[model samples]
Target chain A: GIQVEQSPPDLILQEGANSTLRCNFSDSVNNLQWFHQNPWGQLINLFYIPSGTKQNGRLSATTVATERYSLLYISSSQTTDSGVYFCAVARGSQGNLIFGKGTKLSVKP
Target chain B: DAGVTQSPTHLIKTRGQQVTLRCSPKSGHDTVSWYQQALGQGPQFIFQYYEEEERQRGNFPDRFSGHQFPNYSSELNVNALLLGDSALYLCASSSRQVGYGYTFGSGTRLTVV
Candidate 1:
């Protein structure tokens, strides 16, 4: 099983601020995804980026597969962005995905 | 299309009791995987099912088991539940042959008393 690590276990910022969350894996991955778990506990799929970069609204993510790491960027953050952001990856062809502990973000208005 | 659907958004049971949770994968998805997310912790994989068969599993015990039906719907059963069994159970579905990630459900919150 591949090990996944997320930095800045927690974060807090004022509304409209920007922040970056990082995730590092121990092995090469075939699948990589970023997720936002809202206060209600629903995992909103952020991005499925095995490599390259992608953006959705004020959020974007970049994955460097060769380096076994990924980054999620939140610009002009809002209160609705307060929740846990998680990074997960699949090491092999098996359908199982390993998840990092996540970085808890709180944006105060 | 409808995303992954889970039943009984919340549940409470006493220790030693048995419980069952259900999940329906997204349309056109043929694989289902179960995960347990404890409070203040990341989700841990439970097991995955494809074609009505258990394919891969995690570190859970036999007390935690699951079944997948012909339609790709699935059920997770826990026997003699303990307080530690309390957590949010998430169901994810994917196209295995396509080698893509998964679309997770909102999850079922289980509280074992």
Candidate 2:
């Protein structure tokens, strides 16, 4: 089994600020994704960067497969960004993702 | 096109009861996977269905079973539920041909009394 660990179990930021969430995995992964779970419990797909870097609006993610770690960045945060950010990975071809405990982000106005 | 769709957004059942959750995968996606998310924790894989068969399963018990239909819809059935069975059940869909990430449903909140 693979182990996925996320850092900064909790985070608080003021509006318009920037923050980064880290995810570390215990083994090499074939797929990795970043997700934002909104207050209503919908898991919104943020990025599918198994490697390299990608950006979308105010959110971006980078995964270093060799290092077995990934980072999700949120810039110019808004109160609507308040929720849990999760990083999940699949180590095998089965495509079953093992998720991290997530970083609970709270953005205040 | 619609993303993953799950039924019965919320449910309440007594211990030792049985429950079934339904899911319809995203358009053009053929694989469906189920996950369980306990309070304040990450989602854990329950099992996955492809081609109307169980492809891969996680470390769940036999009490947890699932089925996939020809149209790619799926169902998760849990029997003899316990109080600890309470959690958010999520359904994710992906295309094996596309070979990318998954799109998740809003999930079903189950509470066992």
Candidate 3:
């Protein structure tokens, strides 16, 4: 089994601030995804970056597969971006994903 | 088009009871996966069903069983539930091809008293 660790278990920022959340995995992975769990408990997929970089609106993610780590950046954060951000990784030869505890982000309006 | 849909948004059960949760995959999806997310924690994978068969499973016990229908909809059955079994159960669906991401349902929150 692979261990997934998220940094800064909790975070808070102003509405217009920027932040970076990190995820480190214990082993190599074939799949990696970022998800945001809203206050209403809806898990929304943010990115599916196994490697390289991807940007969606004000949110961007980069995964360095060789280093076994990933980063999620939120720019000019909005109140709607407040939620728990999770990083999940699927190890080689396994379909199940191992998830990080998540970074709980709160963007104050 | 509908994303993943789960049944019984909320459920309450007593210890030693058995409960079933249902999920309908998104359109054009062939695989269904189940996960459990406790309060303040990330979702934990339970099992995945494809082609009406169990293809992959996490560290869950046999008490946590599931079935997939021919249409790709699925059900998760937990027998002899315990207080610890209470959590938000999530259903995610994805296409069979590689590089296909998952679509998650709103999830069913189960509380075992």
Candidate 4:
């Protein structure tokens, strides 16, 4: 089984602040994804960068596949961005995603 | 398009009973995967179905089984449920042609007593 570790288990910031969350995996992966689990428990897709950089609105992500690490960047963060950020990776021949516990982010208004 | 949709947003089952959770993949998606998330934890892979076949599974026991219909809809069945089985069951849909990126549903919150 592969292990995924997320850094800074918890984070807090004021609205409009910037922060970066990181994920490190134990093995090579064919796919990587970042998701935001809202207060309602819905997992919203953020990015699916398995090996490169991608951005969607105020959020961006970069995965250094070779190094087995990925970073999710949030700029001008808003209260709506407050939630748990998850990083998942797919590997092995089975292709099931392995997820890190996640980084809990709280953006106060 | 309707993203992955799960049915019976919440359910309650007793020990030794069986429960089924349903999922309909997002339009144009062909693969369906199921995950379980306990309180404050990331989703844990349960299994994946593609082309109506079980392609991969996690460490879950035989008590956890699933089905995928020809229409790409899916059903997860848990037999002899235990309190430990209580969790938010999530269904995520994706296509290989689209890489492994997935669109997950809101999930079915199941509680076992």
Clashes of each: 0, 0, 0, 0
Least accurate stretch of 10 residues (summed lDDT) in model 4 chain A?
A89-98
lDDT string, candidate 2, A1-109, tens digits: 8899999999999999999999999999999999999998999999998899999999999999999999999999999999999999997545799999999999999
**TM-score of model 4 relative to the true fold?**
0.97
Q: DockQ for candidate 2, please give it.
A: 0.81
lDDT string, candidate 1, A1-109, tens digits: 6999998899999999999999999999888989999999999899989899999999999999888899999999999999999999997655588999999999999
| lDDT digits (tens) for residues B1-113 of candidate 1 | 99999988999999999999999999989999999999999999999999999999999999999999999999999999999999999999988667557999999999999
Candidate that beats the other on TM-score, 1 or 4, i.e. the better one? 1
Off by over 4 Å in 3: A92-94
lDDT of 3 at A4: 95
Provide the lDDT at A52 for model 3: 97
Q: Which residue pairs overlap in candidate 1's backbone?
A: none
Across A1-109, the per-residue lDDT of candidate 3 in tens digits comes to 8999999899999999999999999888888999999998999999988899999999999999999999999999999999899999886423677889999999999
TM per prediction: 0.97, 0.98, 0.96, 0.97
* Residue pairs whose backbone atoms clash in candidate 4: none
**Interface RMSD to the true structure, each candidate:** 1.3, 1.2, 2.1, 2.1
> Which of the two, 2 or 3, has more DockQ?
2
Give the top-scoring candidate (TM-score). Answer: 2
* Candidate 1 interface RMS: 1.3
Q: Lowest lDDT 10-mer window, candidate 1 chain A?
A: A88-97
